[model samples]
Target: MNDQMKVRFFKEARSEENFVEEMCNFRCQVRSDLEERSRLMSEIARRAPDEAGARYLDTLIDRQKRDEHKLVLLKELLFLARVETHERKLDKLDDN
Candidate 1:
């Protein structure tokens, strides 16, 4: 590979790894948030007004859904990056 391609490949690999790490961190945060929300919901259900508790639960659900969507997008991006890297390596071989 040319120097430029090599630099690009390293950059992309680093970026992909960083994204995957972020995705993992987000997943862990979501799990923790879900656990905390569940506890809050239980408490709210027992002591808070029905409407208020429901509204809070709905907001939590919405946030969870958004996080899930972001995780999926990041996974797809990582897959694409791996595929591109593989293709580039194959191209190099073909040239030789």
Candidate 2:
């Protein structure tokens, strides 16, 4: 009812929307990076000098896999946040 409450609520709503948008952008960027890395990794592997070099490349590939997993979790969390906001809106409507 107060101006302060309205501002705080609006800011929270804006922040959540911003968060989802940022995450989506970051995920797209990371996906492109992963594609580039995968392409380069294979090219480098073809010319790798020794076992250690090959192993190091493998490590990089593994790290990329982990990053992909984290991105999936981030998307899930974003979805959950959006669902929570929707539920809150429905509850407010019911209260009215």
Candidate 3:
């Protein structure tokens, strides 16, 4: 390919990698935030003045756990996609 095309492709690849890395970082932060929230909620539930308040906190914690699970799945999918992208790029290089 032409020099300009190669440069453009390189830029695009770099941008995509950056985007994926950013997403991974953001997800990690969100997961950490959720963990902290759950921990705080658990502490509050333990010292809760009423049963109802504890139950409510339990529900919130469950929701956060579910959200965290979904986020983990998405992170795994993103990691696989990145690996596949690299594999394809390597294949192309081999072809050339």
Candidate 4:
């Protein structure tokens, strides 16, 4: 490959790697956040008065749902990254 082609290929690969790494990091963060939220919910359930507990639980539940949605999106991103990586490998092979 010419210098320009090489540079383009390197940049693409670097960007893809960065995206995959970011998705992985996001997944880890979401998992950690969910765990902490769960712990807090449990603590509130144990200690709060019935009405207060109900309100807190509702808020936590909403947050949990949002986190779950974000997790799904992150999983989709990881899947897309895998697909892109495979396609890139195939293209490389075709070029050879």
lDDT to native, each model: 0.63, 0.70, 0.69, 0.78
What's the alpha carbon RMSD for model 3? Answer: 9.7
- Residue ranges of candidate 2 with Cα displaced over 4 Å: 1-14, 89-96
Which scores better on lDDT, 1 or 2?
Answer: 2
Model 2 score (lDDT): 0.70
Tens digit of per-residue lDDT, candidate 2, span 1-96: 235433543555567667556657766876787788888788778888589878889888897887687667656755776787688779989999
The segments of candidate 1 whose C-alpha lies over 4 angstroms from its true place after superposition are 1-49, 93-96
CA lDDT, candidate 1, residue 85: 59
State the lDDT of candidate 4 residue by residue for 19-77, as single tens digits.
67766886899889999999999999888959979998999999999888777766876
- Best-matching candidate per TM-score: 4
TM-score of each: 0.50, 0.65, 0.63, 0.78
Ranking by TM-score: 4, 2, 3, 1
What ordering of candidates by lDDT runs from best to worst? 4, 2, 3, 1
**Candidate 3 residue-wise lDDT, 8-91, digit = tens:** 435545566675676576568768878888887877777885988778887887878776776766577567658867987799
Residue 65 Cα positional deviation in candidate 2, in Å, after optimal superposition: 2.2
Residue 71 error, candidate 4, Å? 0.7
Estimate candidate 1's RMSD in Å: 8.5
